[model samples]
Target chain A: MPSHDRRLIGAALVLLCGVAAADTVYVTLEKDDAIAVIDGATGIRTRTARIGKRPRGIALAKDGKNLYVAASDSDAIQVIDAGTLNVTGTLPAGKDPETFAMDPDDRFLYVSNEDDGRVTVIDIAARKAVKEIPVGIEPEGIAVSPDGRWVVSTSETTNMAHWIDRAKLEVVDNTLVDPRPRAATFTADSRQLWVSSEIAGTVTVIDTETRQPLKTISFKIAGVTPEKVQPVGIRIDPARRYAYVALGPANRVAVVDAQKLEVKDYLLVGQRVWNLEFSPDFGRLYTTNGLSNDVSIIDLASHKVTKSVAVGSHPWGVAVRP
Target chain B: MTPALALKLLIRFNRLSACAGRILLSSGIVALALFQAAALGGPAPVRRQTPAPVAAPQAVERLTLAYLGQLAEAAAVRPYFEPVVADRGVQGARLGLVDDNTTGRFTRQEFALAETRLAPGDDAEAAFKRLVADGRRFILVDLKPEVLRRLAALPQAHDVLLLDVSSRDDALRGGDCASNVLHLLPSRAMRADALSQYLAKKKWTRWFLAVGPAPEDRLFADALKRSAKRFGMKIVAEKTWTHSFDDRKTPESEVPVFTQGSDYDLVLVADEAGSFGDILSYRTWLPRPVAGTQGLVPSAWHHTLEAWGAIQLQNRFRQQAGRWMTEADYGAWLAVRAIGEAATRTRSLEFEAIRSYLLSDGFALAGFKGVPLSFRRWDGQLRQPVLLVQERSLVAVAPVEGFAHPKNELDSLGYDEPETSCRAKP
Candidate 1:
């Protein structure tokens, strides 16, 4: 049989297995003002949807209908219809919105306005900002707790992770971490919160119950200097067994045991990896490589990079929809 | 309402506790309520329905820093270059104040810079006295070694912390180290060591040393010799350039003959004033590369540096100073930023608290050099990655790959803690 027919048969087999292979991975190209959509099964870029200028920190609606992208330069979040792959509306965000976290209930979005040093809380239903909670300087990373009771904003310059009370809409506590904190993620159990410090090259795990740091996991790779191992974006596996941290400029992702709070292995990926997302079924992981302008597909079962799909210029944020 | 009444009200409110009183006073809401009540002439009812005590107000702390330097009588110029007239060091301090205030606005801290530039023949002691009398406790010094030594020896110097941003003489960090002085600029030995590491990494071990006539040039050449010895490199040939030539009138006939005796991999120029080194790169007898003070110069900061978010700093400096940031500017900026970082981290403006925080393990500052910079305890020298840059581009950053240290890799490019002679501590 010819190679083309063999590939066709392989595709038919995958589809006939009842595997939901129509999932789409959306990657925000920061410099190109667009989002590249990639087919999850084929690992091929499907289309590019034009977004607001300098769009970063993408989040899909819980129902998988609308996609929200933080347009850093435009100071707004561009809402796109996931089915149509077209922008639906623009929601006001604070100045220089670099990252955001949508609440579990999908009623509110917490956007980290880096330059403004505040987190703008927006009502998803109203599509407008409702409150601005002051945080430490240069707030970048934002994560809402799994139970939707707390929101954490990591300030890069202040080196503090602010825990904001969802009910009070005020910063209740500030926990100092390593230098240049960039990303935050909560475990599936909602008991541990992991924050990545890009410059200090460490991931600080904070206990949600006590509001104290439980451990600081440091990364050291062979042949790579400590200064170059900058941990930026973090994503916890759906089963809460492993945590993947994107070590910027190290061109690798650190697989950390979520419960043990230790780095298990450093999986080599692409250059300057920034953000990551997992497939709906947790069978694969997608990472946006900023410098290499591509996305690495990691097969969760094998814990290795299976394929790399070229994306757009300086791809930064990623979102996956089933 | 009379000012006395307001003072009386505040004193009565202070009975709650100093911290609570401060919170109420700084909140601006209490004052607004008081004004409204006073306008309505009904203070009793308003006092009964006081709003619940909210979070503490953001209190602003003010810190004042001083810049002390001397204006040279004559601006130094290269053979045919423009005279350098601008006070680059002071400009950096000013930019530092701007940067600190920017972060300050959000952190409830205000920073102010007091600049004092002495004219020629001005008594340095008198200027120090005036600054001390003005209650300036932090000083950023951009002066020669002689002047710096004189200022450090003054009676009031003990009360002030001096950040040396200009001088690179090794003796200041070694034998003549002052208890009150912290060196921000990399010493000549550090620069030479950085270059030697790069040279060793490139396998260019043999070098021809060319020393200039000035005393500073001799010191730099001595540093180069020490670096070559430390890094296990060989100095193939050495010469002192004592002759001067007018670029327009001199012929190229003697250039090749003057450099012909050397059979080395690179020519190390020690001209600190840019007098003769600019003419040595392409004019060398051997087809070797030129480095040291001119060619592949090792500096604390360079215009071509764009890594570790340095481009943001460069853009900010250019926007404020209307020019590119120079090495001296970076040194001064680092000094002021060190103070800012300490103040922000410690949340105290006390000199001792800030000083201790700066020397402690908690004082890692992001200097846009790809690493968090800190100070060496043995000597008050800022440990940073030195950039080896050409005129137009960054060639490499020092403490090259594979060079390992038992402790910090940055120690590979400078005097490590074990070898330092200075014993100053906070």
Candidate 2:
């Protein structure tokens, strides 16, 4: 009640806030049912939290105050306080929320629920799943257009990608291709979308406006089976001139010419290179090699694997600090 | 010639000319025969009638080699399959892996849909069946166990010989074992036995414990314990870490501390969760080294596994994937290799034919597992020497100095048939 007491209470609150901020770290989704919070700078995993069955698909809110993780086994998205790494809330999205994309403004989030054959849209501020848009079978990758006008999801089973207008919450077009279209990344200027066909062992380039596959670039590596050169995750540099793809069984990343849609070269990485993350500045690309249980660091400037950091077993998902 | 004389003379002349001509012709014929004989030197030189082009030796056709796994996209198995495919006279080969979301983990959707959606329902089994039903005989599968099982059970695939190349789970080998599943990856028990025998040989008997929740992890732990017991080792301390919980302090502290000092010579943490096991190393209070899931780990393949004739395999895999070898990549590679070996040796892909050949005494597969690999008659698990590796390098192999089995060396490592809890037969 006294002024001095109020000051003491305020100081304690500030200290408590500082402690929470210090302890809060990046959350890493594990292959099984666990999420590990690793110090962003130290790289030491501070604590591991068990969430839904087979926890994966992690995304931080724009303000960095909250984190949403797909507890795949439980079929729900668990929201945690970014500062404390504690579950603050949860929302049921769809059958399996494997990967998702957030809008530029961070107001809307789109998720590719692989099992349900649908994309769930969530209102970030409302903390709720707003809509579920049906897609082709085995929808895996989801990406928002640079203008935030449309969302795109790739269906593995259908070997196609569906372009949806966020306002309409409807599938406007489908870009058909070979089997197992896993990942999709938009060019920097938003003129084209690059899709990786896992089963066909090729990368399909599509016109963003027409939503039609225009060019398909295929590479045949000797000794590598056509069945195993599955292309999974994909990303384009900010300049939009170069595209990098994670080749699954191939154990390499295919660098493509953005304009020509031709494969430039394959950069080698760890065994079973799965998901990947590029530094915000696009200087370093980090890839998770599931079977090897390691993270490969690729220096983009050199376009080669610079380091392989041993991480948890079955390193699944990866995220980097801005 | 006149009358008789002229006729005689003419006849003589004609006869002489005819005789001379006959002699010349005979000489020419003789010379030709001698040259021909010389040309056809040794045997009877039997010339059989030529057959049509269809009957000529068939040229090997290029194949599309498919690989299926959770992380099929990133594994280095391409190297192993690539060289084999090239050397085997395959005209061309294309490899395809299953697709996943950005994270390497397979969602329920990806796993389920992958079964039917990967190719058409006309996958290898269907294609093999259609080909077999139409009279084609051979088939090779480096597919997962469930897929292999499903395909083998199909009536269409019955006549089409199939080779099992993946899925290392021992149950698939011993009990639930498919008559057709020819595994490329050594069973978990084989690896456990490898480590167990090594520990026994080193006289490291006492073991501390940290077990995770998965049934597979427990099985591995049980195998380790079985090997320890067979080698006269003891499990002194045991602790369980339930998933989905967290503490600010280190979870490694859950292991009880004894004032009298630790009882075990090594701490074996069977944490397959992948998140916590690496931290268990060097964190244990014990003065000795750790084993099992972390510390000194036992695996079928490692990228740094260069010794014991594994350099070639390592080189091939690195060249293909541009990365070191992972256990799964090796497993997949072995599966494909097993099929190739069976296909080439037996010259048939008939399921029964390949199975019989693979089970025969002559079938030995050279995986990158440091030794010749084969299946046990009793359990059907691949008999292998497990590599005990530390810091990415192989430290030792199993069937340690003193641990001995009457029949096979791999038997020295895991639960013997006599002590077996797995009651299934091969």
Candidate 3:
């Protein structure tokens, strides 16, 4: 065996003993009603913290002290302490808090209230739902631009992304997308927005400057049919070279050339991959697979699925701590 | 009032409960905006911001849809079912209009539904002509088979797109199929085939068919028979429900004795009106699962469907109609959304352009069935997944995993192009 493989085994042992401080990957177990914590160093699930019912949409605080989880069935955004993996508090997120985008400064939690066709903005510090902004019908995927200038809510039925102006606190523009858009994200520089449409089997990238769609990238896998390639979670590399899209049920993560806006490769992963998160150094990508109840770890450099660590039932969203 | 405006009124009055969705997200704003909306005691008003306009704004293109249905349906209504809804077909169309208008709000296009309900014995042709005369090109007919057939026969309606939202006439998809008519909901044959496909995957080959006495029950039974034959299943024994005793009071002997002779893996009931199928679950002679109209049923939409962005439609319908969305409502909603999707994509106001776009291979509408549903060119029936739901939970979705088709997997659940007798031009 290579020395690299032996070093990985040694790191796995240290993680099994639960004694080291390394990059930690947090996964929301949508079915089992818990959050699975895995050591990024070893790619082994070290802990499963029972949280709330049908937890999804996880995010780590920039300070790395708090982890926010959208406990959808419970209808509350549950905050857990990163150090102890224990739920710290529940934020009043308004009915059915499914997917949420936190402010870069951690001031507000913009959650998509699916049943209401509105976005409920919860004040993180106050633990109260401060504002309810109506968007298109069946709003699901939500995003806050890195620069905090805009909040875009992707409505599934309306098939449009509502651009909410931060200062105005109302929808300033709407970018029409493909049907049943499931996920969305803003580029690190907040210059572009990428949305994945599950039903249309395509990813739409919008130029944030004009709030207009720049390109619509449709996926066509060799053996897999079009309908099966339902795009869900989208994550652009910090280096801005590649944008990874989680193809739900197709069990593949499509890697697109972010600069060129074209699908370059498809990396096979576990079943029903729903969401993706990057490791601290941007060296690895962790994905939560809903059907297989596991998280696939992909080495960014090699662009390969390196490991599949079994987590709780129906792992949905993934977050990482440095 | 436009459905879009009505929906806004509902949101202003209704405080919707937050629910969960399994998907992806980030940003936050100051608490000042909440204070602004808090004064209204409701959610902030959703302003439909039209795209950056021209110096002289072009007139908004308005598309009006006509809904035709009877105030009272002649079909048998179960005395024991949920309270009779006043707005069944129209409500669904109204919600569909709301969604279409929401999308249209950005494109400078406005969609409206002009709903018309006839009194008993009202002339169907008069209403159809009036709607067309009023410049309504997209008409959703929720009327009975005879009324619909009458409208389809008119020369004035030949060029117009007439949508069948509530009718379940299998023959309409066959000899009576119209060139301009399109179907949104699943027919009896499709529903039966959906149930049979799930049962086939489970290897449940024997079905003891207990058909009720209603004329509609017989029709449903015929579909069940065709589906059973198609799926290679056998009706080990068949019996007509002959009991006249009140099912609610006398649960002791009727179903058990009626179902006694058949030794089968499943007892399939064809009770269209909910006359006696509700009691057949535990009352069957043998310990077998029951399915068909009551015990476990196949439907296009249900309240419990949260996956594939269905909850969004269910929520919007509930908010607008103040009730659960039914099969009729879903069909009506799909019909309008279909027209809206075509119009939005093709950016055309003309009937031929939208209709031709709908018939083309490029058109597909996301109806929250976990798949993009499209109309079949041969029969004009919407190809969609059927939900096998037991009262409280979604049991399964059909076109089960292994079921395959040359064109699409959903085609396995209904009459394929080759099997359809729709002789109208494609």
Best by DockQ: 3
Model 1 clash pairs?
none
Residue-wise C-alpha lDDT for candidate 2, range B321-342, written one tens digit per residue = 5556665556555544454445
What is each model's TM-score for chain A? 0.93, 0.84, 0.93
* Candidate 2 off by > 4 Å: A1-27, A37-49, B1-426
> Largest TM-score belongs to which candidate?
3
Over B1-426, each residue of candidate 3 has an lDDT whose tens digit, in order, gives 433343333321111111111000001112223323432332333432223212233456867778887643335544544555656787888777767776765565677667777655667788889888888788998887777877887888876888999877788887788887898988889899999989998999899998989888998999999999999999999989876666574766677878896589999999887777888888888899999998789998888898866776777778778899988899999998999888888877778889998989778799888888988898989889999998699999987888877668888876787888889853
> Native contacts recovered, in order, as a fraction for each?
0.10, 0.00, 0.39
Model 3 chain A: ten consecutive residues of lowest lDDT: A13-22
Cα deviation of B345, candidate 2, in Å: 36
Q: On a 0 to 1 DockQ scale, where is model 3? A: 0.36
TM-score of each: 0.76, 0.42, 0.87
Candidate 3 local lDDT, residue B66 = 84
